[model samples]
Target chain A: MSMKRLESRTALVTGGSRGIGAAIVRRLWSEGAKVHFTYRAAEDQAREVIASCGGAVSASALDVTDAVACEAVVDEATEKLGGLDIVVNNAGIIRDGLFLSMEDTDWAEVIETNLGGVFRICRAACRQMLMQGGGSIVNVSSIVGELGGVGQANYAASKGALNALTRSLAAELGPKGVRVNAVAPGMVRTDMTGAVRAVAAEKILERIPLGRFAEPEEIASAVAFLASDDAKYLTGQVVTVDGGLSLLGRR
Target chain B: MQNEKSDILKTVTTVIAQALKVDEAQVQPGSSLIRDLGAESIDFLDIVFRLEKAFKIKIPKGELFPEKLLTDARFVQEGKVTAAGLEELKKRLSGADWTQFEKNPQVSSLGDLFTVGMIVEYLSGKLAATNR
Candidate 1:
């Protein structure tokens, strides 16, 4: 048997129960990395992902918003998986509303989960990675962060801050042999987008020059590439998988 | 005994100079680690790691720097370190001078308290405790 791409490596993906996160978990596992994934409320789905992967994939329930919990999860994953080589910060929440109508709770919840959670986890993981000499971190950002969605002010702000965080951490940790990058996914066929797709399928498809929504696996492939040695020199860059939606410019 | 203390100070200065990428002569006994030596938050971790390797002793977080003091409300009041905080710092860093830190007790200036002599004293005490 030929050696797999991620053989002997270990990965931890946050919010890996479904959608692009689940696909990333599967892809990393398929590449032969020992994977431990986290889910907030989808225990059964998380278990199913582990069962399907069939090798070293495992699942745990974690609330990314909790700083102590995030630290514990990183420590636990590193201990169990034997060493953390890759970290995918895919855990985020979306609260859609106009900026004026958005409640303080909505803004705080989204920011705490999406941006602050990444901060906590990355801080903990970087400690371990620095001690070990090298590692890679892939943050799951969104095109809304760059382009700004009409009803997603909170989500947009959170992901926008995430991109800045990715760039800053990349510069700080680069000398320590750690790499940080972000993936800004656009119009993926996830359960969250299914409701919007039903309402504005054609309108949404018109913006994408690709003329189709991206499957979760396609985004996962980009994430897997960034996490692999093939992208050893890539850092502080945001790879947009938006099917040219961003290129349309304010459409 | 005086020679041993001077030797420990020289070794501590060398380790800190190497960690911060500064010349040994630039790291004076009274020079502040942050203000004078340009050691930032991340640089603290590198310095600690290098100090551990150079001295062959463990320096736990919050022992040498006391990060927890930064969070305590009683120790930090009105965005600055209170007189109480300076008392705690005096106890923790008994070997170094605290006159400048006392004169300017703003929390932002807390890093200014960490002089090269302070690190030498902290590591010397740690080594003494371990050896004893």
Candidate 2:
């Protein structure tokens, strides 16, 4: 916050009304970025996040599943903030089910929102970023992408494809100066993960060497690094922020 | 006609120079985009995107570059472009030179079809068609 690494930078974060996305918005704003964020149906929570930011941060509703809205949000964020320097693709939905009984909607919604939404958002943002000469993009992925969860076949496939998409886009856009990367969180203490923790809190803790779930801020810090010049040389990488849970090899 | 060709070449040279981060003087008419200028597959995508923007024309995928023709089973045998394959390429990309390539026609040499002069000629044709 003191050095203000992101000073003069304008950022847009999706799914920012709660949990990890909220932390990213706060972290970017603290680092001196002009922040704009989106929420699906959390207008109240969005208000609180903006109020808590203690600045002129703006919040809007975006499903991220809507293709046209995905394009519009990027355009709005760029025009409102003057220019876009950073984008965080954090909007994702989880529909965990055993493969045998998983509904078609579960697979379709997870893939469409989590994986396809990133494609749409990045495609739209890349056009603007390319025009601006360069920018940074960070997709909030999950360790389940690398270590597939037993009951999360739909979720797992979505995140795995998301990581691959990140690498592919990085290769395509690197020469143009746009950086693309992903952060695979092990288990962050977020509203989205509340149900998973309620079911297997002790089992999950036993896996992570750190002996606890990550604070949302912990994952946000890693995303902030990738968004800044500190990771300027890096591209096409999946930075795992899982407290060595992945090191345990999915136990 | 001579002045227009020179103008198109100059713009194509600038676009190539910017995309590949090369000196403008190094991108000559006979220079092979990949072999001579060190353009990787990714760099080819960059050059194509920049060319479309600079020329204000949509270069359809696999058109400017004979991507499918190079991969067709009928045209290629043992990694060499067959006589019929050469004919197909000749019919397809009118601006690309086949005079030297006909001598070898190794599938690898297909990249040679994408020369600076070829792109200049291709754009000249595309621009003329659009203007008409």
Candidate 3:
């Protein structure tokens, strides 16, 4: 099938150097959105993604944790694309530790990169979007934020704040023609969860009614929809892609 | 000094109240800022900034808040830290031998704590010193 659904739009995905983020870059490109992505430390991976993607993408070195750097990246992407229409705040990190044992640096770093970084990007994007009439933002939150995980207290709190931030931004920007949403995927097979024990994976799979971890493309497809015209009516929503894990306990 | 302490407590309570969306009276020195008061991390940051502006102080960044207090989600969850405890932590932070504290891995939250009034007082001192 022709995947040109997103033709004529320009998209930027942070953390697009590898794994789920790289998959998102590819999917948006396939759907005909000119794409730009950023990586803090993955120079080779970022270059490789762009090189292999058939020449309509750009990748930059950016540490999303820095508010100034985030604004610059948005500026550069909008400059390259002439104007930006979609932004995917996919860049994040996990500083896992139980709350009791977690270090101050651990909590601050995760909050800075994951939650504060999203705020910086969204703020910059909103300014640009408002000037340009409108845009769409797809922030990548995690299932851990909603369900809460034991060892991922910092990660969960960051993601939880991102969820709240998403709602607040949507409320403020929706009237300006900008749409803000989040995709909270559970147990997606990515480098972020590379160490998941087989037993643990099985346990989670059982919890998911679909009984499997999602491929990166599955999550990317949802992102594409949110960034497209079809989803114009949807804002301030988190479309969970955990295959019913969140619904298992429901009657 | 006692009156000053009361004033600090009242000012800090008002900042916390504004951030927590509660009545100012609900924010007594012993009132729970997080749990009974329902303050989140952002609220903590917000009140910290307000306290700085109100009293004129600069709290150091980078885990300056002691480990124990930082990890206690109960500040928002249980609301258990007493005003006296908060004051003691503040005093300890003032005399904090940064070198000794950094070398010790004992991880006492009392050592790294930074409260609204503490920052307010620090800023006040700085402004006074500069004026001199």
Candidate 3, A156-181: lDDT as tens digits: 99998899999988987775578999
Poorest 10 consecutive residues by lDDT, candidate 1 chain B: B1-10
Clashes of 1: 0
* A126 Cα displacement, candidate 2 (Å): 4.7
Better of 2 and 3 by DockQ: 2
- List the candidate numbers ranked by lDDT, top first: 2, 1, 3
Native-to-model Cα distance after best TM-score fit, residue B19 in candidate 1, in Å:
8.4
- Top TM-score prediction, candidate number: 2
- Mind giving the per-residue lDDT tens digits that candidate 1 earns over A131-214? 667899999999988989888999999999999999999999887789999999999999878877999899989988999999
Clashing pairs in model 2, backbone N/Cα/C closer than 3 A: none
TM-score of each: 0.76, 0.83, 0.64
Task: Give the least accurate 10-residue stretch of model 3 chain B, judged by summed lDDT.
Answer: B104-113
Highest lDDT scorer: 2
Please give the RMSD of candidate 2 to the true structure.
3.5
* Residue A151's lDDT in candidate 1: 87
Error of 1 at A140 (Å): 0.2
TM-score ranking, best first? 2, 1, 3
- Lowest summed lDDT across 10 adjacent residues in model 2 chain B is found at B40-49
